[model samples]
Target: MTDELRTTMERVGERFNLGEYEIDAYLAVLEHGELTASEIAAETDIPQPRVYDTVRSLSDRGLVELRESRPMKIVAVDPGDAFGDIRSSLAEMVDELEARYTAPARDTEAVSLVKSRSTILRYLEEIVADAEYELALSLTPDLLRRFRDSLEERVAAGVSVELLVTPASRAPSPEEFDYESVATEARARRGITTPVIAVADGEYSIYATQDALRDDRDRYGVIFNRSALGFLVSGFYGTVLWTTAETLATDGESRPFPRTYASIRRAVKDVHELSGEFHVEVRGRDVATGNEIHLEGPVLAHEFDASEQVASFSVAGEDGDPVSVGGLVAALEDVEAQEIVLDRS
Candidate 1:
């Protein structure tokens, strides 16, 4: 009832892991002691069924006790103690789930596409919680409209949802919409800040997007959850699209990236892989010293900071895979190179 008491309960509730609903129940019962289940529900605006459970929870932990008679009335115990017990129980459950997921698996490969509703939810939930630094999302409007509530709940619980909704996606009548403002209320203090987005999350990344113009309703979603490989791909290409939004200066061209943010969406058949021509430098003594082999045309760019008279060359390869030592020697020899000087510093 008093400011001092509310702040105390909030800190206590945090310790015990009480959500807003639980906190409301505690405070309302504190003000009006000895109330029936229905009365508490009405006063607190919690569902009648949930109110009974909540009160029962309080009673179990000595926060509330039922008067030992007919038409049983409930009394508030030392609100803090009752709420603390609730916190400990919840914490144990989360600890269990974390342990369950952290165990090593035989299938070390990352998941490509997840389709089932329950599994998809679990996947998203894992991605949301597993995010150590940031979580990026390019949500189809339809998908967001469907699971909007579930997504908002994550935001409420201290998960920073840096969302990416396309220009074409429209809100659901403005009333069913508004993830930012409501989330700000419950999560702002807990570190859930929004309107921040990038497909890359430092070590691991996922590219989730849909073409609204071609398909208004997204049939399925894709998730790339690999760590090392995903990071390499994200480093090269993810920022290009993310840059379209983040780098836009007020006076500068609104679209900072050369093409629309969807440029990669068109070219990228497998959105998980980074496909492009990336420069690679070679270094070794005697350019023609290595075994002569067929050269990959136009793909390699040779840079000799100091030319043992080193020459430029191109090679064909994926970003994540490492270059073979022998392959480089042969490629150099195929170009009929002389005096190879490796750029290795």
Candidate 2:
């Protein structure tokens, strides 16, 4: 903090920070080019007694010039000249402030609630940009469009993105939108009941109602980062909102194995569409023992519930018996998979 810099900042602060009367008087004189104290009081709401003090304050700030003629005129100084020093000082001050700034640690919290719309939007963008492999999102049409460019970039970088836009009626038709550029697959759900969600690489996620993204007083979004609890959000998206969505577009582009998944339902869906024997490596926890388990073998069978919300696969275990694997909090299966990797047998 040099003395000169400190003085310049103080001068700038004094110059632009104005009271109501001073602002009114300054603008009145600027608008009329020049005006007497009587004219200024008549043109603005500043009372006659306070008009002299207001104009004098403006003059001291170098915003206006005072003429020593009869009636004492107040003249507006060209704003370009008046504000040049202030602008320069502001730029310098901002540089100094930025130098001292420490970014808030985003990964320190496991779960957080955010209320501001801008903050929610920022988190949405951050999650989208941060995804390295798989990304799943449930968004409104406007939010889809807002982040389409970033999504497209991720797709181009070989990141698989599955997008769900709701309510289905408001989503763009295949003819009007190029879904392939932004998503590996894109779908539309029939109602606004689908919450706005973004999951990045299965670990970081955000969830909020459609109302939370809108301009309303009561709104909130939840953020999950580096937490085991994040799987709950991804599971809900895959089994709940995603299964009910009607496919709007799919590239049908086959990605080479080994592919990884955070959602078992998605992994099962892809395996169901395959032709022959495929191998899988499951990183998960035993349902009964609550202990970590890793299983790798040729996939024997895959199952889906009537609604297709629940999905699991059977693989030969250590004793040559089939083990059933489900996603997230898997109570009905032998193991709850946190990540599933697939490849050729």
Top-TM-score candidate index:
2
Error at 36, model 2, angstroms: 13
lDDT of 2 by residue, 230-270 (tens): 88798788878888889999873466678888878778877
CA deviation > 4 Å runs, candidate 1: 1-27, 31-63, 68-73, 83-101, 104-107, 114-204, 209-221, 225-345
Tell me the lDDT of model 1 at 34: 73
Candidate 2: where is the Cα deviation over 4 Å?
1-86
Q: Give the clashing pairs for model 2.
A: none
Query: How does each model score on TM-score?
Result: 0.33, 0.78
Candidates' lDDT values, in order? Answer: 0.42, 0.89
TM-score, structure 2 vs. true: 0.78
